[model samples]
Target chain A: MANPTAALIIIGNEVLSGRTRDANLQFLATELGALGIPLREVRVIPDIEDTIVATVNELRARFTHVFTTGGIGPTHDDITSECIAKAFGVPWEVHAGAHAKMAAYYAAQGTEFNAARLRMATMPRGVVLIENEATVAPGFSMENVHVMAGVPRIMQAMFRALAPKLERGAPVVSATVHADGVFEGQIAEPLAAVQRRHPALDVGSYPYFRPGPVRGGVALVAKGTDAADVAAAADEIEALLVAAGGQAIRGEPRLDDNTTAKV
Target chain B: MANPTAALIIIGNEVLSGRTRDANLQFLATELGALGIPLREVRVIPDIEDTIVATVNELRARFTHVFTTGGIGPTHDDITSECIAKAFGVPWEVHAGAHAKMAAYYAAQGTEFNAARLRMATMPRGVVLIENEATVAPGFSMENVHVMAGVPRIMQAMFRALAPKLERGAPVVSATVHADGVFEGQIAEPLAAVQRRHPALDVGSYPYFRPGPVRGGVALVAKGTDAADVAAAADEIEALLVAAGGQAIRGEPRLDDNTTAKV
Candidate 1:
């Protein structure tokens, strides 16, 4: 089968206002990569109900799985669950399971569960709770859409809990050979050829800015599941770089290990 | 008047694959801030034309302006202009003005205008070109939707060109007062109170991770265009933080200068 496709929806006004630089998208993208699932798209919408409904409905129709990373808080702007319910035509009410969890949390803190805070317990019909280890309010999964918390810690915890449950393909494997003292344009053509040879692997070039304004090298990364295919592709790419008068540094075997752990 | 509202649609599948860490969202967010046009949301969708058209319609109905980046290049994935035209229900053809710009760019590069390259010149009807100083392919504005290049360097140039033509609101100003040795939960109540006091100004608390595993502290950022109001909110926020047994780091004065330059 093909790679499992996913999309992320980051909902908040704080992100767009420059009030916060989003760290969630980067985290989810890398994490999804490790799970052998390719994240296909991401959208950051505000607290608007109509916008949320429209985006969720459209994405659900296209992607196999959709993950939303905000607007599930206790505040009034946390309207994701309600809007999602409206979109799916599901009756939304406080989930008995989720409400019990929230009540216990508020009770433990010796705080009264106000009406506003109770909104956290509301969920779409027939959805399973994505157990939240960081907080009391659990995220919910409706069909293929996983609605998680906006808080980074909470979102991370929910993702960890859900990873094992997901259907994963052969995880995308990658190897990187770093090059120094070569311009990107000089190697773009040869890289294209390398890609053509290894249709199973993705060959990519990334140019970075270094000191002294030197024409810094490209990091040729080959991504796929088959180790032999990945290695062969990487070797072909490195050979081309060397032929183009650039040093291809074969560093540690674990050069792309972080990406492996990220998903 | 209310802040000039805008939205962004990032068209690409590469970004979602973790192959591309998006630089456009941050660039456009900061640019919109400088122009006093508040970017309320951002969506990254695949190369699907229907998704693009649907998103454009939804955003155009709500926002004062919509800026779409990517999908305007020579490749097959670049179909933003055609999709946008369909969204607006207007007949799209290669604008003579845009074609002239593309011809001049190809001439400068000493390359023939390949048929695939002409795709860049296709634009929606009744729109004016947003001059591309970095490259020959011009970005265009059809009604309120601005179609621009996806490349970071080119997007920045288009933004600079498009800024003067937009009607800006009173510039939004912000002040940050950092509190060391505090937790997010510890300050949530006081932050809420501060927000209640200054409804017009937005106050946000962001927790940072220290070198150690400990939660470093929260940065209390208050934003608004009114200098006096922002200052007042900042003063109150700092006082509250200090009272909560946290060290307050005085943030910079001007809010507009806080953005990181991309191009």
Candidate 2:
């Protein structure tokens, strides 16, 4: 609960058009949670100038830090950099440091340093560049809004480089207690009671259904900044599942099977 | 494009806390896009009542249709139905029809219709219930805002059942042309030229990376309501790729290889 809030703006027409499933949100969410900065909101908008500018401005003003992915590439649709500048009401121009680094990197790699390649260096005036080891076309951070490549690999790299610079908060930890054969309908009231008992910590009931009559299952998660408190809540939840005749599992269920639905 | 716009509000602390990756947004986007309803914005928000109430109200007012996933189960965390009622300034109560149907179905299945299971029958006043064939706990539609289960299978079923009732819109179609060895930097200018020529159709350059220097690749997509216009623009895009010496492939690149970066 003491964690700093963050918001992500995914600027891609492809995502909105359902051409691709986003891989960034989960990676960013897990990383931010580890950094003790809970991701509060994520907005997936198209590659429209007005939408990008407005979304960036709105989220930046609301959350402690804002991150954007996609539309920072060297293409006509990659207008996130310019739209970000418009959001902050600053001049969009090429950064000398970024330009030098990219030009030298491209030359060494024998990649062309054309006008489009140079567009990667251009950003809002007085911005700090977030370095990406891959492709060398660095993502930049204008104020609190960190602009990263939409590609998952590059986005992860930029995030790691920038993670240390973020403001710290109490690390959020979670304890999962699964009920393999327990239905939510049977234990909803008691789980509500458990939540009321631990007002500071959140008690989440995740119901995972297998084919043929749901298999009547649930995964209860107790999460908070305080270790002892979270553990206590988890214990109470585990007891609840046991009393309700659940074959309780200590850890989170395997997601690879893909049957687990976090209801 | 004469496509109707849709916004999705993913209500879950699990998604925000990084415990679970959301699977509903992409499914909804693809489904809505097929219906000629372009998904304009998607918000992933926490399960907090205030956030849910505020987001539902905001999105309902903006887009032609607003759909919500998650938090509709029979648990303490399942508060989306109540929050939606709050958003509409209506009293949250169990609809007699839903209650009766669920009760009969549970009795037939030899499942206990307990207090928590009864909660599934509750909804806002004057709402039309969206029936789910899988589970007797039907999702409800209040005006333009449709509420579905967070579970992907259940959500998809509910959407299909409700799809026929939705207003028809101009169907959005796409034509994809892939340039496997051509980078965005190489064709950014000419791609812009193609975009300018098309004007109406949105041309997106999706650069895919294959671990070694991006493999200098991109997948150009021309999307719009008009089939002929999209095809013509795609043809021009393919010509542009040919002129740039790209080994142009028709249609979208393999997402199965999991290297396509939808930038």
Candidate 3:
């Protein structure tokens, strides 16, 4: 069976302005991959209403799940909730449960539940709240679209809470075979042949350059839902590397394992 | 005048699979922003030919410029060049100049110029080369779409070489005002008013949470092509912060810079 597919949208002007680097996509990608949902696409866009609304609608229609991070704060730039509501053609209003939670939380902290803070309670009608134990405001799920905060800690917390609720498919298993001093060009044809042999698996070759002892090398990875297939393909890759006059390591090498490289 | 817009396509499975964190997007964003070109959108997609071809065609048609990184290596997964050629409906073949360069580079390194290595010389018809001083294989440009390597060092080198050839717009200037211990909710309305006052500037508010000494804070940034306008809006934001009973700092805090935030 094919794994469920997902798309991620990262919304923030800070990221587009190069003032901040996004950390959410990779974290989500790793988690979703483990849950048997393949992330097909990820887009980093600025916090603009038209762009956000269009992107949200497009992704939600294309992928089984769409996760959006950023622009859920209590500030002028925090327009994600409203844009999402607009995309679904739903009325934007403050959810009573979310409002009550934020109010109670702020009261306990001795902070006033001001109008600006109250904006966090706003969402599209009929959306369930995504829990945020790390922060006061909570993310919400409207259909397949999940909106979460941009902060790393808050985003992580929301994702952890939301992951269990999502539907799972067959989890992808991966195996890596590392070869030292093996130029990718020298073994490309054999790698292609190996890939052709296992048409169901995704075989990828990544080259890495290191200074001093380990000049450079390539890592061949085989990934599939079937662990046996992935392992078998990995073995074939190892054999191919050995036949090419290079030593193939069984697994990914640690940084300290550079001493095993043949100069 | 509005700046020329650009879109970026990150092509790799390692990034989508979460094995490798992407380092090219931010570098491109910063460089594009400084050169007065706004990076409007960035999409990270897997190393699939159909996806690459469709994405390349869509982006090249929509944006003034498109930059793609990854999958331009000498391996089975390196299909970006052929996919790009297919997208343009042009025939793909080995460029004599590129082939000569790669052959000479390999000869100097005492390596045979194998068929796989020769793949690096392949490109779409009527395309110009983007030099890669860090590596032997040169990237290529077919009209507005610029294809480069996935490695950070090589990508940077290619971008540096290509930047001077692109048309430059008016550079954006920015000013930031940091307010410590200021809850964003307390000043959201005032910030919105300030934003309304300067329609040309891009006003953004980013919240920060620190331990021990500083509990939480927010940075209000004003960006625009006009320096004086950006500075004026920043000053107004600082005044608004002080009016809301918060200690406003002129510049962003040092050291407390959240390095843990993902890039």
Candidate 4:
């Protein structure tokens, strides 16, 4: 069976404005892959209500799980919670658990649990709160959609808290073969033939450039649910690279380990 | 008047699989923003033909310009060119200019311009070629949609070639106020008030955490077309931070210059 699919909606103007480079997607991708969930799509959208509502609705319907980050803060630009509520056609209200937690946490800190801070507690009806140990404001899971904070540390914590509830599939296994002094264009045909032999595996060719004695090379990766199939494909790729008069390393070549003589 | 909007479609399975992190979006976002084009949306979709075609069509219709990176290689997974051709309902064919360029480039390096290598020359009908100085394979521009390579250096070159052809709008001006020892939750309300006063400007509050004695702080950014308005809003934010019993720096605080005592 195919792995469960997921879609990540990164909601923020900061990312779109090029002011902030998104760090959440890579973390989520790696985590979800380990959990046997294939993240199929990721949309980095601005802090716009209509766009958020539409994107959330579309992704939630298509993928098995949908995760959102950013725009759930105490500021005016934070409109993700309300947009999510609108998407589900539910009334946006303050959850009792979230409210109590935030209020108590702020009281303990001797900081005012002002109206703006309290806004973080708001969520759609029938939502389960995702714990945020990094911060007081809790993220929530509404059906298959997990709404989390944009902050990297906070988002990681929330995902960890919510991960146990998700349905996992067969974990994907991957193997890489790095070919020294091999141009992707030169080896593309042989690589494609190997991929054709292993129809079940996902084969990818990524070229890398370095500023050293060995200037460039290609990394061939084979990914699939079946370990044997992935290994077989990697073996085939290694054989192909050797036939093409190139030295194929078993794994990714470290930049410092560029001892292979250039062809 | 608002600037022309653009959307970026990042086509690759490697990124979604956590095998590779995307670097194209940030470069495009910064470049487009400087050219007075707001990068409103960015979608990282897999190298699936139907998904690519549908996404390209949707983004092309909605935004003034659309840019796509990845999947334009000599490998089996490189289906972006064909998908783009299908999106525009045009025949996918080898461009004479691209074919000649690749053939000559490979011949110069004493490499055979094989069938798989020639695949990079395939593009949609009526497309203008975007030069790739880093590599021989040329990216193309079909109407407002610019299709480029996935490699950062190659993509950068293609974007630079295409930038001169785009409709440039008024560049956005920005100002920042860094508040030392100020919590985002504490200053959310005041920041909102400042945002309200300058409705035309885009105001954002981003919290930062440091490992040293000065633990936390907030960076208030005011962005807009009007320089004077941005400066005025930034000044107001500085005053508000100072009133809240914190030190407000005019620009982003360099960590080495953080001599200000913690509150």
Candidate 5:
């Protein structure tokens, strides 16, 4: 059977305008891949309500799950919840559970739940809260859509809460071999053959612009849950590189941190 | 009036998997901003025909201009033209101009137009060819949507060709100042105030991370089209930073490389 798939929507004017370099997408993609839930789409849209609504609807309908980042903060541009509510044709009202959480958090801090901050509690109805230990306001999930914070630290926290709920597949395993002084084209066909031989494994050749002063080489990585298959594929690929007049050094077989191990 | 907006659709499965670090989005965003046409959205989709068709329709309807990258290569995944043609309910055919250009290019290289390579010539009807001086198969445009290559160099050439056709506003000018020994939060309010004072200009603060032996700092950038306004606002911002116990040093003004001065 095909792996479950997910999509990511990044909402923020800062990201689109090149003001903020997004680190969340990379993190999410790597995490999802390790879980064997392939991320199929990523949309970066400005914090425009209509754009967000359209994207959320389209992506949610297409993928098994959809994840959104940014615009969940207690600010004027933080319109992610409202847009998501609109997308699902639901009412945009203050979620009681979320509001109570926010109130308790502020009460502990000896601060009033200011109206501006209360906006963070406004989430879609029938959504499960994704805990955010880093901040008072937590991210929430409605249907298959999981809304998370934009801040990298808070996002990581929210994902930690949500990860346990999702069905994970066999852990993705990867083996890499470093081949120094090799051009990409020289090994493309041999790598393709290796991939063809091991249909279950994902064999990839990546040419890195490694800071030549320190270390520079082409890294061939074979990844899949089937350890023996990936190992055999890596051996074949490395041998091919060696025959192509390149020095191939076999590396460690490590668990891909991004993929989730089956519970 | 608000800036004329554009949207980009990146069609490929390779990118969303974290397999390819996306370079096209940044290049297009920066280039479009420099030409005064703000890029409002970017969507990276897999090679699914239905998804591409739906996104193209939605974005084309919402934005003034739409540009799509990838899926135009001479490979099996090169189905952008067919999908786009289907989306518009138009007949799909090989673009004669595109075919002629590709034929000549192959002939020059002493090769025939193979069937696989010829697939790049197919485009939606009534589209104008966006010249690709860097490669044989050119990107084509229909209505407001311009379909371009995915490779960075080729995409850049296609963008350059389309640049002249676009009606640009005053180019967004930008100036940067480096500040050492100051945390990002320390100057956020002052910078926000500077932005409030000059609403036209966009003031951004970026915190830099230095490795083991180097010192870290923050870079404040002021960007907008009105030179005197941005410069004056930047001056005031610098003064505020200096008064706030930060050492701010002006670096350089960003240049418009896409457009040439008509002397």
Candidate 6:
């Protein structure tokens, strides 16, 4: 069976405004890749209610599962929960269990559970609450849509809590063959031939350069669900590099790495 | 007038596959923001032809301008240039200037100008060439859509060269007030009131946490094209933080940054 598809929606004006760099996309992408769920696409959008609602509805129907981060905080800009409710066409109401937990925690701390704080407990009428390790407030899932915190730590915790329940697929494995001095132009033809040989596997030719000294090279990576096919593609690519008169190194290339006699 | 809006389309399967972390989105966002072009949305999709063509067509119509990166190389996986031509319903062919430049560069190095290498010179007909500082290959602009390299250095060079011709809008100014020990629940209500007062500005409340020692806080950021309104909202947020009984700092909070007397 084909791997279940996933999409990520980042609902934040801060990220787009460049005030903050997003750390969640990399984490989520790596985790989802390991879990064998292929992430099809990712959308980073501003914190607009209509945009969030529309994007959520559109992606949820197309992908097997949709995950959203950011704008779930307890402030004026935090409108993701309500927008999600609007997308599902459900009533946005506070969950009894979540409300009780937050109310007790706030009461113990001598803090008032005001309207804004109460918004954390409110979500779609029918949803499953995803547990959070960082705070009493929890993210919930409506249908195939999973809502999580924007903060990297909290989002990770929420994802970890919900990971066990998600459906799994075959994990994609990749192998890399690096030719430090062989630039992409020299090996493009042979690499294309290698790609044609293994149509099912993905062959990627990445040309990399180190800026300070102007030293450069290329890395060929083969990826597929079948480990044997990926391995065979990698071997062929390594041979292709050797035939190009460049030394074939069986790994990824770092920024400072450079070693080849011929151009 | 409102800022010129931009949308970024990152075309790469490696990025979506979680093999490589994307560094271009943050750089482009910050650059576009400084250039008075608010980036409204970003989509990271795999190197699929139809997806690229459709996304390019849809975004070019909705946004003031669109910038795309990756898949414009000399390999089988590099299909961006052709896909863009298909999207615009134009023929994809090698530009004379680009072809001459690449051919001369290869001739100087005594390298064969193979067909795979020639693919880099090909692009959609009737497009302006964007210069590349890192390599001989050039990126191009097709009407409102700007296509650039995926590599950070090359992409930045291409964008810097293209920036002078882009339409600019009002540069967004922002002010941040951080309350180190204050949680969002304590100040959400008052923050919402501040947001209501300054409806023209975007008031964001971000709660931050430090992992090692388990310390957390909140930061309120106010942003808008109008400088005076942003400052006014920031002042109100600082006062609100003070009213919440937390010390208000006048800058952004870093990971190791911790200064608070009370919670």
DockQ versus reference, model 3: 0.51
Q: Top DockQ: which candidate number?
A: 2
Q: Give the range of the ten consecutive residues with the poorest summed lDDT in model 3 chain A.
A: A254-263
Residue-wise C-alpha lDDT for candidate 4, range A187-256, written one tens digit per residue: 8888889888988888998877767676878888999889999988998999988987889899886643
TM-score of every model? 0.72, 0.96, 0.96, 0.95, 0.69, 0.95
Model 4 bad stretches (over 4 Å): A255-263, B254-263
Q: Against the true structure, candidate 1 has what lDDT?
A: 0.75
* C-alpha positional error of residue A159 in candidate 3 after TM-score superposition, expressed in Å: 0.4
Residue B262 displacement in candidate 2 (angstroms): 14
- For candidate 6, write residues B1-263 as lDDT tens digits: 77789999999998888777787888898889788898999999989899999999999999999999998888889999999999999999989999999889989989888888889898899999998666688889999999998887778888999999999998888899997678887888898899899898888878876544547688889988899999889899999999988899999877532222111
Interface DockQ of candidate 4:
0.47
What docking grade applies to model 3? medium
Pairs with steric clashes in candidate 5: A34-A258, A34-A259, A34-A260, A35-A259, A35-A260, B173-B224
DockQ, candidate 5, vs. native dimer: 0.18
lDDT of 5 by residue, B1-263 (tens): 66678999998765766665567777788888888888888888877889899989989998888999887755444578999898899998888888887788778866557665667788889999998566667888988999987666677888999889987867777788866655443565566678788887766654454433433555677788889998998898788769767787897323222111100
DockQ of each: 0.22, 0.61, 0.51, 0.47, 0.18, 0.52
> What are the C-alpha RMSDs, in order, of all predicted structures?
7.1, 2.1, 2.9, 3.2, 8.9, 2.9
- For model 1, the stretches where C-alpha displacement exceeds 4 angstroms are A1-4, A33-36, A48-63, A71-143, A149-154, A169-263, B89-92, B101-105, B212-214, B252-263
Query: Residue B191 error for model 3, in Å?
Result: 0.9
lDDT of 2 by residue, B1-263 (tens): 36678999999989888788788888888889889888999999988999999999999999999999989998988999999999999999989999999889888878889888888898999899898666778888999999998877788889999999998698889999987778778888999998898898888888876655545478899998889999898888989999989878888776542353422
Supply the TM-score for candidate 1.
Answer: 0.72
Please provide, for model 4 over B1-263, each residue's C-alpha lDDT reduced to its tens digit, 9 standing for 90 to 100. 66898999999988998877788888898899899998999999998889999999999999999999999888888999999889999999989998888778878889888888888888899999999556678889999999998888788888988899999888877888887688777788889999999999999987776666767787889998888999899889999899878898888765431121111
